[model samples]
Target: KPMTNYQIPQNTLLKFRIFNEFLMANERHVAKEVRDEYVDTMSKIYYSYFKGYSSRLTKLQYEEAAARDDLMGVEDTAKKGFFSSKPHMKNRSTVFTLGNRGEVLTTELEAPVIVPHAAAKNETRYSFECIFRSLHFALMDNCCREFLFISDFFMVSGAGSQNLFEAIMGKTLTLFLKLMEDSVQDCYDSIGIFLSAHIVYRYQSIMTKRNIPALDRYWDTILNHLWPRFEYIVTMNIQSVRECEPNKLGHIDNRPHYITRRFAEFSAAIVGISTTYPNDRVNRVLGQLQAEVENFILKMAAEFPHRKEQLIFLINNYDMMLSVLVERTTDDSKESEMYR
Candidate 1:
């Protein structure tokens, strides 16, 4: 059966719409606090969706599991009920016996459910495969925030967990690289593929430095191979798109924004700026800024003079707060702040 496409919650969708509207609006300024609040809510929504999606395996997963079991010749002994208990050879203790007829009774033992080794192996393989597939789709689906959250959690939980995660990440990257080649052959967005791959690779390289030192060597090799190949593929893809959609090529967004570099950059930039780090002082400052302002750039660009003054006041106050927290003796002049 085809899996039903689970609809994202209506309220979440509404908030997303409003967020995009506010973020992209040219005429009106959205406050920084408003933007941050919306983003927080959006993060929660995406997390909820990711959790739900991971918890329930799709029909494809079930099919794959069954196929794997069949290939492995895995049998469930409990399901077959093919068990017989044997009595002790000596039959040490006998039941009551009569003079004419004697009868010995033995208690029947129940067979415990036994899982075949092959079956257990198949289960483990299926679980890992499903997780990789889910993450792959999640990345492509623009649920990268959720992917980052899950992957980070998995990496730090324990040594065994980290090893399993890195292994699967490697496998997933290899598969994606293969797919990227196929996509290029089919005249798809080769540059986009390279870009996304590099982004993921860079992040994985950074995040796994402490846990998987060997992966750095592997990454060096991959990057060396990727550079020249990426250049060639990107050039070819550009020419192809240019020839195919002459007038609609370059800056023109013929289809959805998904095919454009600007959209990808914008989305990534938002995540980078909005995401909180582990550092206590930085988190506190960023959190405060997010709480106070509704829209940073919009206010700067607003026509109203008072709005500009408000932005200045906010910045000065923020700088003063930061200076006190850091206990730095540096000048807090507007010029210095702007340069910094």
Candidate 2:
């Protein structure tokens, strides 16, 4: 008395096969009116089968895996539903009166589940901490909180926070303005971070498809956008440090100025560390780094002609300052070697 896999009702199977044959043959040659009617009829049949299968599988969620075999029965119906009516999915909401006097009411509401802030905040904090620790171990280890603050600023700005636009000067400015209104710390929601990774992946995929040059081509766009902010920080920190300690005497006097002084100090520290054991390798690396920075500026100027002169001015000032530091370092090294 057991049913066979292929033992569908004979009459129903026959009718379905006939309809299928008609569809395959008439799809291209059928009169418009007949095609429309056939499509409408088939659609209704498809949805009915779809709903029936969905209801049954939902019930089976609590059932044993042995019952999973039944899912195959409606797989075609489900596929039809997905392709045919995906755009028409609607939210369902209802209210019911419970009491005799209608004083008590019950409501049902549905929405896409979103990650809660408490969970999101924890995830953001964890990601920031992990990245911070990694950078610390990588010899770029100074200014823990300062780097965090910059990351936070970028996050809050949101405009250029995504990898694709982060290098753009205009987007960076837009993000800066936006950051003024919100805390960047709060912007690192887990979902936002996850989506950001996906966005970056998609951008890379498109760029690869287009056969674009990766580093050199995009360098200028990023530098032009990032350098103004860098310059702003330098200018701001110089003023702040000077204001904090009018006389730059000792570590004690500088302690109060550390907040703003950290920026310049960090830059100098990196340069010093890179040259501690000087060799051709060190010089070559430094040259490459400087060239990259210059390329970034050139790219920015090329992309934004209106601001080309202004950026060139900033680049010149930056180069001059860096050159002075190198000269001083060379002098001190020679003097120390002579004494030794």
Candidate 3:
């Protein structure tokens, strides 16, 4: 039977509960292949929605132009008035206008002295919002059901504990429900895809850097210590989230976890640290981390013995995931080929 609107909440709630349990209880151990599958699925969804949105926004600009023209007549009223003014009016206007002009004027000036400063600021803040709304609607129409599939999968995979679960689920569901109602699933989907890909890419980068002693030391000291606390201070100032809430959501949350804050700080610190590190020190750290990551991969392969092929696949194709993430985050209009 086709699902009704009323069924959505119930389905989402059930899925959330089920997914949370799976994450918490599943000891089956996911293969690298499985993780890669999620990465690929997420990338595909993100790129599709992103490209579709760019196209829709382009069309929307044209449509908005047409709508504005339809509403505000295009004839240059100011020009018409200036041209139609009587000689006296022109002389008076000229005196005020020609004050800045050369004292000994030729028969004609190449351009208008003041150019009337068109001042046609067609402030379309509301229209832009509507265009965003339209893009969302288009996405939801096509991909909402599929999005629920991924959301459900993540929810059950023990991404957070019950309290954290409720918070994340509540927020995610609220956004989903709003998108469903407003028919803006496309925007939501695009964001979700981008976010998912971003998370994966970050995780991969962190994993890659695990072996580097200096890098790890830098991250541990800067990110794990100073950064998270700094973020906590900012959050306290904003008074955004309850002090008691878990900070797992990072920047997405008003009050993120200390760990989440640490991660952000650490990541931020790396950018600064990279510049300070001597070339030899940087190379040494990178070499160490690469060896460690390779060792870790080998250990994972051994433990999952049967999944060697999948691990190889992931190692070989990881760049694709990063590429998708970069494409999603970049401005689409620059070099249309970036979309591919």
Candidate 4:
């Protein structure tokens, strides 16, 4: 994660360049055999560095994920958003979105038991942020520089250098993407993937500033790759709620329903994440989700036998949902104050 402060290797490529230059300066022969040996040695350097780095990066992600208690808990934490985590650049102008104050909605509003929706409860996760940071460090930051180095060193065309780089180092990129795809395909929590996309998108600005036009397609490809899966997950969630028949359950509880909590938590989580990094497309999705949740609440409220009971139940459930969002308030903002 650009989310975590995990350090990545720096200046390691510079050392490789120094060694290559040193070898070239000291070489005693320029015969075919000598040139072939030199090229072979350089090939090993590129291949070994990238392959080794890729494995380490992937391993680090697994380790961090396992340390988390569970995927559901992770999603719960994310719902509050990461605004307080501090932005990457404090120098950039900052704007804060205020959150509503959670009213005293309960005579005893202890932690509402989160009866999680029917989703996989994975013990560990392959963090999207970790994958994003690691692969990005290797490809855009590390491999980009290394590829340029190979081109200049061997006097190969940029295209040829790309092929050479892929032949040796492409396995790492493939592995990273495959891992991301597999993780997202079977993700227990989507908020992580959702926020991670923003991380990838932000790289566009970095790529522009660095002026590496050739590599822009790589990140774009990544976003395109995960996008469909993300949308599918979001769609499945909305569809589930849309098609749900709350009337079938022949029970009425004055307390908040599990589905209600799921919706509330989901809404709050995305709002929190989006508050820090707002996207129109994501907001549109949130809007749809919010609408479904409201409808669901109305339907759920109708389950109660009495009009007063139905009204009270709706209030309780709405308060339950509102409390989740309100607790995630930012310290400086004018927006929520108007509604608060």
- Give per-model CA RMSD: 33.2, 27.7, 29.8, 12.7
Residue 41 of model 4 has an lDDT of 60
- Winning model by TM-score: 4
What's the residue-level lDDT of 335 in candidate 1? 20
lDDT of each: 0.33, 0.29, 0.31, 0.53
Q: Write the per-residue lDDT of candidate 1 for residues 1-340, one digit (tens) a residue.
A: 1111322343344445545445546523454344445445544544554444443432222222211111101112211223534321111211111111111000101111112243345553222222333343353333233233323432224455334334434444454455434433432222222333344354344446434342444445444544445345433333322333222323421121222222123222222322322223323432333322223223322322476554564455444433432332135422224324
Model 1 residue 14 lDDT score: 49
Model 1 lDDT, full chain set: 0.33
> What is the lDDT for 261 in model 4?
73
Q: Name the best candidate (by lDDT).
A: 4
Clashes of each: 8, 4, 14, 3
Report the candidate with higher TM-score, 2 versus 3.
Answer: 3
lDDT of 2 by residue, 257-278 (tens): 2221222233333244334223
- Candidate 4: worst-modelled 10 consecutive residues by lDDT: 95-104
Of the two candidates 1 and 3, the one with more favorable TM-score, higher being better, is 3
lDDT score for candidate 4 against the true structure: 0.53
Name the weakest run of 10 consecutive residues (lDDT summed) in model 3. 64-73
User: Which portions of model 4 show Cα errors greater than 4 Å?
Assistant: 1-128, 147-175, 329-340
10 residues in a row with least lDDT, candidate 1: 101-110
